[model samples]
Target chain A: MEELLANPYVGPLVLTVAIILVFPLIVGYMVLAERKVLADLQVRLGPMRVGPYGVLQPLADALKLLLKEDIIPARADKWIFWLAPVLSVFTGLTALAVLPLSDRLYVADVNIGILFILAMSSIGALGLILGGWSANSKYSLMGSLRAAAQMVSYEVPLGFATVTAIMCAGTLSMQGVIDSQFERGVWGAFDNYGLMLIPTVLFIIAGTAETNRAPFDLPEAESELVAGFHTEYSGFRWSLFFLAEYAAIVVISALCVTLFFGGWLRPFPNVELLEIPFNTVFPAGLCLLIAFGCLKGVGKQVVPGFRFLMAAIAAAFLGAAGLFVLPLTNELVIGLFWFAFKLGVMVYLFIWYRGTFPRFRYDQLMDVGWKWLIPISMAGLVLNGAVQLLARG
Target chain B: MLIDQVLFYVLAVLILGSAVMTITRRNVVYSAVWLISTLVGVAGIFLLQGAEFLAGVQVIVYIGGIMVLFLFVIMLVPLEEEASQRRFSNQKWLALATGLAVLAMLAVIVVRGIGSLDHPGPAPPPGPASLTQNSEAVGRVLFTEYLLPFELASILLLVAIIGAIVMSKARRRQTES
Candidate 1:
């Protein structure tokens, strides 16, 4: 078993399978989180009926989607329509292969790691474009047209911003970027007298546009386009598109964290005095805090089932905190904890953007992508490049 | 060794088959999709050759950037009339002549290099260690050995982009006036 585990190919293969299986659950919970967060921002209780605070809402949603009748428009280009959602989901998940979750945990450490993600995103664009065009509906076609133009325009700034990170790291590999950050004893966002923040901000904006989240979600402007490209899609097919969107959201957030944040490294990684507390205690304490929140909610629940569920969740979080403190699991959990923590923060920012901002007008979206983002990102690139050169000299 | 050969042949077949389908499709959108498949197959071949950076650039620039533009153009055009019109059916002889010329050129190149197949040069040191350095090697050569040509290519692409914008702007002005 040890020999098998040591085989490089076997390890990555197992990791690949694990990511594929686990990511959907993560994405599902992310959807619930988005709803819950959006609800909180709107000052309301959201989906309290499904599970304790709608914890099982994603599972219920998944079952409903799975059991619903799949529909394809009669006039649609059947093959392309069928292929679109699969393409979206496939490219979204495939991009995960290059995402270095930690130094030790990743599927494949390809030399062109970031570029691979970029390429997958480009293909993911194809899924949207094709889905829109194939639907044979006017709205679908218009949505796709917007998607193609928007993605193409936003990608310019996104590429330039990524170039900024790549230049700082002097490598395209994701793991290499984090290692360089560690070596420099600063996150990419904090590098070069904080000039790197320009690209960091540009990346977040461009990434938001790239993923078609508000205020840049012109392609799927529900009020105008009636659900946009997936208008003709229903049931299982629509769910696939939803899955792909959330998967993309997660992937882009992970990319943002990996590029600007210190990735799996704890904040202030080189501060030896704080290392034990930050690495070991902080993670467990965070979980315990969440458990405490759950415990507080247990007394307020009117339903016995809801109260029991709340307590059970509190227990689960307590157990998780327990695992974090255990000697055997401490080191194993630390890296994943930091990575997920950073990732969660980024994901929350996305949800926050959605709740706060109104959608951009179509022309306004194009203006932002071209008139603002591209030039700013380009300038950021040149500035960071100059700073790096001078620092090296 | 066996897996490498198998992957190579599989990718080659996919590339060739998809290229054929790309031309044969009646629907322009279908043709565009097939072209993407062909590009992806080519990218797979590049990956199989251990040129990871080249493989990535192939997918990014070709399949991602170029092909999306192609699809956008194809969709913007009214294809129903074009589909009804005879394409290669009318230009069969001209097509055949051009195809033969290209085939002859390729054949000549292949024949010239055929001798090396039996005594092919040593493969690049194949392992994960060397594989991970593929992009570094590419970056070094591109920036140092072929820097001028690379810059020239970028300038040329810039010129094309500007020319396209100018031409489109000119047409829009004509329509407005």
Candidate 2:
């Protein structure tokens, strides 16, 4: 067992399995969180039926999707239809392999890390295109056509934005990017007299569009395209596409966090006085506060079973808080906590945009992607490159 | 060592098999999809050779960018008519002869190329040092030795882009008039 643990390959292999298993659950909870956030924005209770505020909703959804009758359009290309969702999920999950979850936690620190992610995403786009094309419906074809065009267009600005960070960091590896930010004593977004903020903003905007979220979600604009590329998909097959979309969102959020927000580094990482507070006090306090909120909700549940479930959840949160301050585990989980915190912030921003913004018209989407984002990102890349050169000199 | 050999053979079979499927597929979209698999296989080969950057670029440029555009164009073509058409041209024999001639030329080149090598049993696996420095080494050589050629290539691409835009605008204007 010790030997197996010591083996270099075993660690990554285990991490890979863990991520493949745990990621879907994370994505499921993220969906619940999105619904809750969107509900809060609109002033309503989002989902309250399943397990005290719909905590078990994702699992129920998964089970229902699994047991539901699978349907394929009569005219759909049998092989390609079967292949598409699998392709989407595969590429989405594969991109996670290179993500530097923490300094000590990751699958593989490959040389071409960020490029691997970008390439995987590009292939994921193929899955969308193929899914739409194979569906044999006019709406599906149109949705896919829009998907291909939008991904290709936004990729330009996304590439340029990423290039700015790559230039500043001078390395393609994910861990190296974080370490460089640590060494520089600032996040990539705060570098270059705040000029780096241009790419930071560009990255976020293009990333949102790239993921086909609202205001840029012409491909899947429900009123028009009728659920977009996966219009004909149903049951487990449809859920796979849904899983891929959420997975892509998480991947993008992770990328944004890793590139700009400093992957695992706490804010003001070099400040000695801030370290203990940010590392220990902040995380523990936040968990305790959430636990307290959960505890307060227990009295509101009239049913004994529901109230007990609420208390159990609050107890779980309290245990989590306790784990945060525990000497051994605290050191281990600190990096992961900050990375997750920043990632959650990015994910929340995505949900917030979905709630706040109206969907873009197709032509308007193209216009924004081409005219505004592309040019700004290009100029930002050049300016950041010049700043880095001057700073080096 | 055994795993490396097995992986190489697997990738080779994948590339060759998909290349054949690409040309043989009746539907244009299927052909394009098959060609993507072939490109992915080639990228795998590049990775096996320890050229991670090249593998990534191959996927990004060929399968991701170029093939997506190809599919867009393919969508306009009526696949029903394409599949209904004859599989082979009238000049199949002539084409076969020409293909064989080209194969002969390639074989000759390979034979002569191998003769020039000092000690080549597939050229030993690259050392760890070279594997890690692959990208940096490529960048250094590209910026120094082949700098002018690299710049020229970029210029050529820029020219192509401008020419395409000009042609597109002209056609659009003619249609409007």
Candidate 3:
């Protein structure tokens, strides 16, 4: 019994289960954050009717979606229609199983980790296409077609850009890529005399398109496609699509961090004398600051019940901060801290793009992806390859 | 070991069953989706063999890109008119004869080669486990030993693209004139 309990797989299995249970909640709040941030950007109050600052808005939304009646079109292909959202959610979540959050906190460390992630995400395009076609609505058909076309076009540049980084790192494993970055004392983004940054930028652009975010979200341009492929879907099915989208957003952002930013490695990690303080104090300080802000919100709130929730949230943050500062807990928790921090920053950029950019017309989206991004990324790949050869030689 | 065998049989069954369904389905859209299932099952088989990189490539290139194209074609073709046809058409028997002949020849070669293949060498240096560095090993082989064929393949593709463009351009000019 002890041997079974002490097995190496046991801890990671528990972590995997914890992640599976908690990931949707994190993704749920991501939606809230996006709404709030976009609202702030547009000078509007977002979701204030729920708990404090609409903090409980996602919970309410989930309840409502769960309770709402689901409707399937009478002529729709029943099996494929039902399969689409499940496939979307599955593909999005499967990518999570391979991503390295921190040094020690991924579900599985596959040999071709990055490649596995890319393949799974690309397969997500199939879900969109299938969903649209099976819906028996012209709008759904058009939307899914556009999504498939856009996703495939962007994938080429995305692959080339990833090739550039893999060339720089000389590895394909996600963890190995980060370790190579740390060994070289430079992030992959800033490598190869700043040439790799081209691929990094291309990656970010193609990633935005791949995930069907604004400026590249012609597939679901609400004015044109009426909610796109999911227009015919209702209630829980619709929520599944929404959840899959946000989960995909989280996956893409987390991946960008793992690829370009240093995964779980603090900035300037190679500076040996400063490393300990830099790694230890930074997370502790950030958590404490978050707790302070949450606590500060409690005093400003008007309602007692909402204030109590804020107090609870503030306490949670404080406790997390305490965990980060404590020696044993610090070691256990700090990896998660850095990974989440970088992921949060990447997600912030995603929200920032949504706020700033207008939707790209279909022709322009294809032109940018095919005529511009792919060629530039190819050149970046060649440039990185040459640099790698020369540097080694 | 037991788990691996179980997974292999499961995925192999899935692949073969879906492949049969893919060809036998009357609906083109259904056929394409079944083809996707077959491709995914094949990828699962690769994963079972510990060829992680190969499995990823199979899914990405075949299922993701090519299957989408297949769906596009299926959508374009007017399938309603030809949804149901005579099951055992006259030409099908002739095709079956040719297919069986080819299969029989291949089977004979495989059956004869089995013993020699089993003990061809003392032992190979790398088994599937050491295929952990799958991509690296593949790159090394391609760049060093197979570099000429690889480069030639790219050149062939580029030539085909140019040929296609020239033909299309000539047709457009003729139409305009």
- lDDT (CA) for every model shown? 0.89, 0.90, 0.85
Q: TM-score of chain A for candidate 1?
A: 0.98
Question: Ten consecutive residues with minimal summed lDDT in candidate 3 chain A?
Answer: A275-284
Q: Native contacts retained by model 1, as a fraction?
A: 0.54
Q: Report the lDDT of model 3 for residue A226.
A: 96
Q: What TM-score, computed on C-alpha atoms, does each candidate reach?
A: 0.97, 0.96, 0.94
Q: Ten consecutive residues with minimal summed lDDT in candidate 1 chain A?
A: A102-111
Which lDDT value does model 2 have at A70?
A: 92
lDDT of 3 by residue, A133-235 (tens): 8998889988888888888799899999988888788888888889999999899899888888998999899999999999788878899899898889988
Cα shift from native, residue A341, model 3 (Å): 0.6
State residue B99's C-alpha deviation in candidate 3, in Å: 2.3
| Proportion of true inter-chain contacts also present in candidate 3 | 0.46
Which stretches in model 1 have alpha-carbon errors above 4 Å?
B89-91, B124-131
Better of 2 and 3 by lDDT: 2
Candidate 3: list runs displaced more than 4 Å: B82-94, B116-131, B171-177
Q: Clash number for every model?
A: 0, 0, 0
Cα lDDT tens digits, model 3, B26-55, are 877888888888999989988876667889
Please write out the lDDT profile of model 1 over residues A1-393, one tens digit for every residue: 999987768988888899889888888899999999999999998877797778999999989988998888888999999999999999999998888787788887778889899989999999999999999998998899899998889999999999999999888888889999999999999899999999899999999999999888888899999988889998888888988998888889889898899899999888899987997688889889999999999988898988998999999999999988897887777888888899999989999999999999988888888899998998999998998899988
